[model samples]
Each structure stands twice: as C-alpha cells, then as structure tokens.
Target: MYEKYDVVIIGAGAAGMMSAIECGKRGRKTLLIDHAKKIGEKIRISGGGRCNFTNLNTSPIKYISKNPSFIISALNQYNQEDFIDLVKKYKIKYHEKKLGQLFCDNSAQEIIDMLLNECKLANVVLKIDTKVIEVSYKDKIFITRDNSKTYLSSSLIVATGGLSVPKIGASKFGYDLAKQFNLNVIDTVPALVPLTFNEKILNKCKLLAGVSANAIISLKKTLFEEGMLFTHRGLSGPSILQISSYWKEGESLNINLCPEKNIFNFLLDKRNTSPKQNINSIINSFLAKRLANIICEENQIAGNIGGLSNKNIKKLSDSINNWIVEPIGTEGYKTAEVTLGGVNTDELSSKTMMCKKHPGLFFIGEVVDITGHLGGYNFQWAWSSGFVAGQHA
Candidate 1:
C-alpha cells in the first residue's frame, strides 16, 4: 500500500527539516526524506562543528540573487530573531562569533537535535537513506520514489541543497526536478570556496604555508576585511572565501596588506624617529618576516629606510596599500561551502517559495537562486524560506 502525506519534503537538510516541522505543526501529515545515511551531515560539520546557525543581523542585502527582491518576503516573514527565540527555547547555549554570526556553544548536532525534536513534537515523519528515483505529477497528486516503494503527497518541496559539498551528498537533483516542471535554472558554480593560483605564484608562496594576515580582498566593488590564509596551492580563510563569490576568472583582486593604518605615514613617522632603521626592518616590524621580505624583493625597495628617498617611500606605501593579485581560478565545488546559483527566483513566489507555474511545488534553501553571504546568513535563508512555505504548503 502506498502511503499518502499532505506534504513530502525531499532532502532532510536544515530547510527540509524546518518545513517538515512547520507542516506537521499545522497538522498536515508531512514526511521528510533524505538519501544520506544521516541527517544534517553538512550541518554537523558547519563552523568546525559549532554550527554557525544564524546571523543576528540578516537582511535581504546580505544575500545575492538574480531577483534580489524575492528574498525580502520570506526573510521578513520568519526573521533571524524567530530562529534565535527557537534556539533559546530549547535551552541550547550559543555565542555570537563575529560580524553578527552566531554559533552553538556545544556542537552543530545541538541544532540538528533541536530541529529533530521539534519535528517529533509536531508529529513529522523523517526517513533517511532513501534515494528519490523519480517524481511524477498526475492530476493533483505528487508521486515520489523510495527504493521500490512509492508515496503520494498533495505538496512536494525540493530542498535538496546545491552542489557545494558533494561529500555530504550534494547533488543536482533539485535542478533536474525543476527542469521537469519547466523551471529555469541559473548556471551554478562554487561560491564560498578558496581561490587558486597559477604555477608561478603557487611556487612563490608555497614555502609560506599556514601564514595568515588581515587583508582587504576586493573584487569589483565588493570588499571584505578578514583573515586570508596562504596555502601551498593558493589562498583560503574568511577574506578569500568571502571575496570568492564576487570573483571570476581573469579578474584582479586589490589587496590592502595593512588595511587599518596609513602605512605611508606610519613609515614616515618611524623614519623621522629612527633615521637609521632599515626599510626591511621597518616593514618587518609591522608584517610577518617572510611577507616583509617578499614585499621588499617584489618592490625593489632595498637597503634601509634612511637610504630611500621620500618619493620611493610613497611608492612603496602605495604598493603596500594596493597590492593586486590575479587569481587563476577557484577550487570549485569540491571545496565550496555554498553554491552561487540554482533554481531561478523568478519562477517561484517569494512570499511562499511556491512555484507560480506549478502549484504545490516549492523550492527553498540553496536550491534557489538566493545565495547568502559567507556567514550564518545561508542557514537563516534555509529557515526563513522553509517557514514561509510551511505556512502555505
């Protein structure tokens, strides 16, 4: 006998779980399914285990979308404060990390547990390790797959996420499903991943592994001030990850080696105070020894600060303030935290995440074109979008 559900959500991720909970609460017999052996594999590993659950300051501006206005409705409907209140109610302790990013004090499992517990309370059914072989719509019923068994639902939500972390079961299932219903999908790519360099630069910086410095990585008009790490292949860490979304191949990144202070004036003052200080020594005092050496070598600024003319000092300072590097490419989906593009927002209603072309079909989370900035913003999007759809589904 085929089981029937009021709502069937494919993908037991953050968004799917949230939707299941919401639909269940409304007494709409909901069943959440996942292909993975465990739920929240990505969430369990997010933020180094302490999941960056949500951002305290999340707005539509914090997101990147083809149709930017689409996110405004769902975000306003179920804001970050609502998620925070839920977390608080579960007695889950969390702390604000930085830039309004909040993480659990214990582990990301706390968040998964909280959501699972909420689903149980709401009488939601969760099934894991079930591969969805096919989806068909006949009349008004949705038929979905589970091994050889079939299930029916009045509403189907695809929260299959994106191709960001394939190790955790990321796939193009959502895109394929959207296409079956004639939904347009934006070209997808790795968003919050590390930028890689060509052989020349990689060889040059390979010896400086594990080196990190506060830098302003800018692409186009977007800029992020965060720690950038030097790896054997290229750059990683927060700044690189943040700027990766705005970057494309052949584009240059303007890096401020010292973003907080005016290096020219600082060097000038030091030159006046200590006339005998070497230029390399002065730079070394403010930067890592290897980095200072590299800068000096690259700029051809040799000898002591006392030996260099004021003109040369200005040039050196300007170079330091605006060091530019062109990235060869990104590490791609194998390492990306979130995907940049997915189901086009224009095909779905922002208010409820329901498809305008196909009623009762909703697309939420990273499967949609709305990709949040690198922070707790992505998870917040999952929650908000799911909440909105749960109300209508």
Candidate 2:
C-alpha cells in the first residue's frame, strides 16, 4: 500500500523542516523525509555547535547567483528579521556575534528543538532513515519510493542541500533530480573553503605556521578585511574563506599584512629614530615576531637599520603592504562550508520558489543557485526560500 500526502518534502534540514511546518499549518498532510538517522546534522555541527542562525545584515546583495535578482522576492517576503522573531517566540536565548551574526547562547540543539516543536505543533510527519530511491510524476501526482514502501503526494519539495560536507551525507541528489526534471543546474564547486599554496610558497612560509594577523585580502573587486591565519598547508581564516568564494584557479591574492599601519612611513620613522636597532626587531614590533623574522629573511634585508639603505627599506615596506601569493587551489569540498553553484534560479519562480515549467514542484535553500557569504546569511536564505515555497507548494 502507498501512503498519500498533500506535500512530500525531501531532506530534513532547515529548509525542509520549515517548509513542512508551514505546509502542515495550512492543514496539508505534509511528510518530511531524510536518509540520515538524525535530522539537522549540519545544523547540529554549524557555528561550532552554537549555530549562527541568521544575519541581521542579510540582503540579496550578499548572495551570488547566475540570476542575481532572483533572491530579491523571496528575501523580501521572508527576511532575517522574521527569522529572528521566530527565534524570540521560541525563547531561544541568542547573542549577536560580530558582523551581525546571531548565535544561540546555549546550544544549536535549541534551534533543532524549536523547529521540531513547530513541526509537532503543525502536525507534520517526519521520517528519518528513509532513503528515497525513485520519484516520478503522473496524473498530477508525484510518486516516490523507498525500500520498504511507496508514497505519493500532490506537491513535492526538494530541499536536499548542496555537496559541501560529504561526511554528513551531502550528495548530488538534488542536482540530479533537477536534471532529471529537465531543469538546468549550474556547475558546482566548493565555496568558503581554505586556500592551499603551491610547494614554492608553502616552503618559504612553512615556519610561519600558526601566525595570525589582521589583514586585508583581495582578489579583483572582492576584498575582505578580517583575521588571516597561516597554516602548515596554507591560509585558513575568515578573510581567506571570504575571498575563496571569489577566487579562481591561477589567481594571485593581494594581501596587506599590515593594513592598520602605513608600512613605508612606519619603517622610515624607525630607520630615522632607531637606526641602531635590527630591521627584524623593528618589524617584530609591527607584526608577529616569527613572521617578522621570516619576512626579513625572505626579503634578505639583513643587519641593523643603520646599515640598510633607503632602497632596501622601500622594498621591505612594499613587500609588507603588497604581499602577493598565488594559491594552487582550495581545500575542496571536504572542509568547505557551502557549495558555490546549484540549480539554476532562472527556471524557478522567485516569489514562490516553485518550478515555472512544472506545477507543485519547488526547490529551496542551498540547493538553489544562490550562495551567501560566511556568517549567517546562508541560514537566512534557507529560511526565506523555504518560507516562500511553503506558502505556495
């Protein structure tokens, strides 16, 4: 026998749960299904377990998509403020971290509990450990089958997220499904990941590992001013992660190691006032001691400032300000926070998150082409897109 529902939502992530809750609240027989034993595994692991749920600064501009304006309607319909209000209604204690990111003060489980409670109140059915093997539409009904049973629904919502963390069960199921339905899917790549340097660059700065600094990292028009950390493999920090989204293979990153100070003026003053001091010692006062020594060695500006000429000083100052390094590639999807591209947004309705060519079909969250920057913007996209789909799906 086959179970019938008004709406069948694939995946039990944030978007799936929200859509199920909304559909159920409308008195629809909604079924939320997931292959994993535990729901919201990503949510449980996000934000270091505290879960950065939403960003107060969320806007369509924060997202990147082939159709840049596609996010405007959904975001405007259900914005960050609305999600914050929902958090408040659940009495989930949260704190605003820097950059307007809202995180739970207790545990991310608080968020999971809140969503589960909403689903319960709305009478949404949840089925975990259920792998959907097949889906077909006929006679205005969508049919899906698992190992043990078959199910049917009038509406089907695909919230099966992108392939970022495969350890957590991320897959290409959503993209494959879109292609199966004749929908266009953008070429996918890892985003918000760490950058790995080639052997040449890594060998030069291997000893500088564990050094972190407040710097400005840029690739073309995209620039991020945040903390940059040096790892044994390469660079992995907020600043690098942000720029990685904008970076391409063979592109060199222009990093300002000392963005707060004018290195030229600072070094010139040191050369005048403390001529007897070693150049490395003077640089130590400005940057990390180890990094300063490495920089001095790499530039070969040995001996005391008194012995160094104006030309060497200028070279060292320029090196500090405009440190250019070309990254070989990124850490890939293994440690990536999100996938860069997904289902082409041009095929879907912005206001409803429904497929324009097919009625009763919707795609939301990370599965869509829209990808937000680090912080809480991605979660806000999930809420906005899921909310919009639930209204019409």
Candidate 3:
C-alpha cells in the first residue's frame, strides 16, 4: 500500500522546496524529498551564514546558457521583487551588500525557516533522509526508494541541482534523469570557482597569501572589476571567481592590478615629476605592499625612478598593468559555487520548465542549464523556475 501525491519533487533544496510550496498552495498533494539528513546545507553556509537570497539587478544578461533568452518568462513571472516582497512579509532583516546583492542581516537560517514555514502553511509534505534509489515513468511517475517502498505520482519535478559542492549533496541525478527521458544534457563544468596556476604563479600567490587588491580580471571581452585575493594555491575573491566561469584551460587572463591608474602614463608622469622617488615605493601606493614587492622583483625594478630609462619604466608598467597569467585548472566541483551546464535548455519549456517530450515532468534550478553570475542570481533562478513549474506541475 502506497501513499501517493499529485506531485513528487526530488531534492528538497531551494527549487524543490519552492516548487512544493507552490504546488501545495494550488491544492495539489505535493511531497518534497531529499537524501541529505539536514535540509538547506548550502543555504546554511551561504554568504558566510547570512544567505544572499536574491539579486535586485537580475536580468537575462547576467545569466549564462546556450539559450540565454529561455529564462525570461520564468524570471518575469516570478522576479526578484516578488521574492523580496515575500522576505519583507516575513519581516526578515536584510540589507544590500553591493551590486544589488541582498543578504540577511542575521543568519541564513531565517531564509530556510521562512521556506519551511511556507511549506507548512501550504500543507507540503517533506521527507529528508529518504533516498530514492530509482525513478521511472510510464504514463505515471514512479519513485522507488531504498527502503523498498514505491511512491507514484501524476507529476514529477527534478530539482536535484548540479554537481557543485558535493558536500551539500549536489549530484548528477538530475542530468541522468533527463537522459533517461530522452532529453539532451549539456556537458557540465565548475563555475564561480578559484583558478589554479602552475608552481611559478602559485609561488607568488603563496608569498602574497592573504593580500588583496582591487583589480579588473578579464578573459577576452569578458571582465569583472572587483576585489582579488592571493591564495596559497592560486587566485580567489570576487573578481577571480567571476572570471573563472568564462576562463578555460590554456587561455591567458589579462589582470589589471591597478584598474584605476593608467600604469604606463602614471610611471611617465611620476618619472618627470618625482625624479628621486623609488619605483617600488610608487607602486606600493596603489597596490598592496607585498604584491608591489613581487611586481618590483619580477621586473627587476630597482632603486630610484630617475635612474630608470624609458625602457625600464615601460617594462615595469607592462608587468603591473597587463599581468597575463594562464590557469592550469580550477579548484573543481569541491569548491565551486555553482555548475555551468546541465539539461539542455531546448529540452524543456522556458515558461513552465517542463520537458518537451515528457508530459508532467520538469527540471529547474542549476539542473536546467541556466547558470547565473556570482551573487544571488542563481538562487533567484531557483525561485523563479521552481515557481513557474509549480504553476503547471
């Protein structure tokens, strides 16, 4: 004997919980399930405890996908404003950090508790630590559990997310499920992660570990101007993480350590005016001292600025302004903030997030090929896609 639900949702993360709440609100018997013992582990650790739940400047331009336009409908239907209204309704204290990124003033648990409370109000059933070993569909959806109990449903929603942060239960189950249903799956890669370099570059990073500087990190046309941090292994911080999404192996990145200053011109003017100033001391004014020392050492920039010829000045300037370094690889899924690709966008309807070939089956969130830039755009996608699918699921 099995207790059936009208809608069965897998992975009780952001999307799954939101979808379940909406489905329940619509008078559908919804069951949200997850294998993890603790719910919202990702949310718990997000923004260093205070979750960046949404972004005010969310637009199609901020997201990366094969078909970027696919997210328009869902995002329009349930925009960041709507989610922000909900947060306000819950009276959750929040503030905008920067670039429209909103984080709770207290803990991320406030957001998690809000979703759980909403689920409770909507009569959504939640099952954690319930592993579904298998899923199949033949007119009706069937979920086979590890406990030998099988649950059937009219509609199935897969919100299993992507293979990022494996510690939080991110898996390829969603992608495999899409393939099982004859839907196209995109090749996945780690995104919003730190870039690692060869020993030469790593050694410099190691020396300047804990040092930070405002930088403009660019890969071809794409560029992010933000804070960059030197790590023991390689480069990290917002600017590096943002660029890492677009960077591939063997490609060089043009990093401007001093984005505000025209280095070559600054040096020329400095040489003309302050003839007695040390070149290293001048660079240290704009950049971190440790990093300036490294740059000075690299360029063999010694002693006074007046002693240097134009050639020596240009060499030092180019090294600081156009610091080209190629990353050998990334930190990978273990440290990635999100996954780049998933089920092909063409495989599902953008309006409803439903599989084109399979009726009553849906995919949402990071599993659906719509990876947003760093900040809360990805979470907004989760809320939007899940809300949209919930309407029809």
The best candidate by TM-score is 3
Clashing pairs in 3: none
lDDT string for model 1 (61-143, tens) is 88998888889999889999999999999999999889899999999999999999999999998889999999999999999
Task: List runs of model 2 lying over 4 Å from the truth.
Answer: none
Residue 314, model 2: lDDT of 82
Q: Candidate 3: where are CA atoms >4 Å away? A: 141-146
Encode model 2's per-residue lDDT on 1-393: one tens digit a residue: 999999999999999998998898999999999998899998999999999999989987788889888999988899989999999999999999989989999999999999999999999999999988989999999998989988899999999998999988788888999999999999998999999998877875577788999999988888999999988888888999999988999899999999989888887888789889988888999899998888898788888897877888888987889899999999999999999889999899998999999999999999999999999989889988988888987
Query: What's the C-alpha lDDT at position 207 in model 3?
Result: 99
lDDT at residue 108 of model 2 (Cα atoms): 95
Local distance difference test values of all predictions, in order = 0.90, 0.91, 0.91
TM-score of 1: 0.97
TM-score, model 3 to reference: 0.98
